[model samples]
Target: MASRTAPFSPFEFLIAWRYLRARRAEGGVSVMTWISLIGITLGVAALIATLAVRAGFRAEFVDTILGSNAHVTVYSAPMEVVEGSGVYSSLMRDYQVRAERVAAIPGVTRAAPLIRGQVMATKDGRSNVAEVYGISAADLQTIPRVANPETALGSIEQFGEGIAIGSGLARELGVGLGDKLKLISPEGAKTAFGTSPRVSAYTVTYIFTAGRWDIDRTRIYMPFAEAQSYFNREAGADEIEVMVEDPEHLEPLAVPLMRAGGDGTLLWSWQDSSSSFLRALDIEDNVMFVILSILVLIAAMNITSGLIMLVKNKGRDIGILRTMGLTEGSVMRVFFLCGAFTGVIGTIAGVTLGCLFAIYIDQVMSFVNWLNGGGVWDPSIRGIYELPAKLQGADVAKAVILSLGLSFVVTIFPARRAARLNPVEALRYE
Candidate 1:
């Protein structure tokens, strides 16, 4: 006896393809049908590309900031510069975070005391609010790089009275190297007359620009000693910045550092301080994914509708196949295969287009720039002037999986509906 099951062949895919072609020919695809497939293809492509862009940007921005800033900053709660004998000895007792006994810490590449506060920077009758960062020139390497290599870097080691100004601040105040600038502390001076804050004068020796607008617009660097003298804090710097081989160990070190402070100092991780930024990124990522995913789902719905119409148009053929000894299961599998075939083809095309577009998105942007007459890129309106796209296999795989999953899921409802049709009723209709 012959086997009941249909013989498996390498050309099964060809058969499925022919089935689809024949259906397309008989029905002559409507505009709505064309719209459905196009929608799915475009949505998947756009989502993949957008996700790649977001991932690229997040990685770039976060890594840049981390590279420039210390993993953690330890400061006094009352904003006091901590100083006490046996304090260093006591902190040295711990392996996690040792106090000023820097020699005791194994992973610490460099450690520096720092003072940070807001001060009015004035030059040539122009003044702007700037963040004043005080650091030991000797230990500046432990911190991230600043704009002026000579000022924040060169003089930090020299322990000079010179200061470094940010590019934006420098440009605004019209100050440059060898120029005089005034630092006015918000704290006032006590006197027989009304108390008033004292303003100190310093010579600007370096100009720095880190390329970040916020940093370039608002920061000034001064030697730790100079800042201490200016702030009238003899106790030491307001905080200690530590650099280590592994920044990820900051949390484990924080507990030990806190104990070392003996309730006097507070340690803040970069993540802890930048919680708002991180949270915003997280929210934005999820929102972008969810919103974009709707496009794919919408496309899937279109696929479902198209398949339903295809099944309706093929009812007579289905009846003929049933009469020719096709089982309900086989009939169902046929339509299921048809839907899956559509999904696979659409997904392949979509992913291919998305990957290609993402990889060359920067070139596309550049071409647009060329067309418009090249000039400085404007990020204000564009959100970002340069198009950055990172196409990770994992990201691409996830997107493909998600798109195919939606497509397959959409097939089931229509497949089942088509499968349950009574052969007699289907045949009688035609």
Candidate 2:
């Protein structure tokens, strides 16, 4: 027997094409084909969109952490009381020297001594608790988020002269740049009888957003000297905030960083601070991926339905083709090609749409916000100002695999049914 024409040969493709393009009078599979194509397209596109959003959310979250907060915070131990002097003694007293030592270590980018405390901020009788970060004017400019002059309202030049406040806090207190706000501290002047709450008014010299909801809502940056006096840490800083060049790969420098901070100091990394949040994000991501995959599978079921209908309608034609010397394998290949073609085109279109959506997400959000007449995305609600989307190659590949895999799998049953149909029985009615 002349070797059966290799499966998926030119004639097989021609036959598949003709069947897919069947006219209305001949039992049109064309309508079903389009439905399957559209279903797959939407499914793949939705999968890509979900992946992009999750990637963007994680990226922005990490950015907020690194940009607005320190990678590692070093604390000086054994705060001892200096008798008669009425002051506490600690290794933090030599903060500048320790900061210099930490900064000198390899991979260490910045190390700044800062006094941190919580105080109540009041303006026109409205009061809110705020976290205060006391650092020098020079060190304030080192913060990445507030370093931008355009985004930072007022001036860093006068940071030390007064106090810098978060925009959220400012809004809550109804205070603007140059407005006077009073700060109340429980740790206050120790009188002969007892200590009294310290209250003082300060002008707002600068305002910043920090790209984080909680931070922007409660953070206040004061001068190092001012914070020291206010918090009664006049001898030294509370902790040394360190920024490394590669926070993600800090294992190599951990020993060095530890040695740099020297004895009597503790190291706290960012991972320690946000471990719970990160874990939740990872769990949510995995759950969302599985859920979206089910959606893709559901969409692919449409392909199976369409192909089965096509097979039933083309039963007579299949019988004629089988009698015309076409092998069962050739018949199966033809139907398989029809389904695969629909799947491949749908996947391509979906990928293109997904990438474009991710690339222009900012514009899309802007348009949506405009349509909604504003307040669509509140920073307070979402935790970030902008809606982010990041298109990743791996995510796209996964979507493609899911769509094609499901389509191919579902097509197999119908293709096999068509191949096994007996010509005699199929043409008995005819």
Candidate closest to the true structure, highest lDDT: 2
lDDT of 2 by residue, 1-430 (tens): 2155876789888988887786867554677788888878888888898899889988998888888889999886665467566665553888888899999998888999999999999988899999999998888899888766226688889887799988889999999989999999999999998999999999999998888888888999999999999999987898998998988776787788778777777888898898898899899988988988898788777778878888898899999999888888988998888888889888898888888888898898899989999889888877888889988989999999988998899899999999999999999999
Off by over 4 Å in 2: 1-4, 26-28, 82-91, 363-376
For model 1, residues 1-430, the per-residue Cα lDDT tens digits are: 1136664333334544566774446564344456666777888798889888878776655554565566667666542225643233212113224345542456666556677778888877898999988876656545454623313323433336578776668888887667788988865466788657879888877676554556666888788767766766555556667666677556556655665455566677667766797688779878988987888889877777777877888788778877877676666677677777777777888898899989898787788888989754664333333557888888788778888898888888887887788889999857
Q: What TM value does model 1 have? A: 0.78
The reply for model 1, stretches above 4 Å from the true place, is 1-12, 22-33, 79-99, 102-109, 145-161, 176-179, 186-205, 244-249, 361-389, 422-430
* Each prediction's whole-model lDDT (CA): 0.69, 0.86
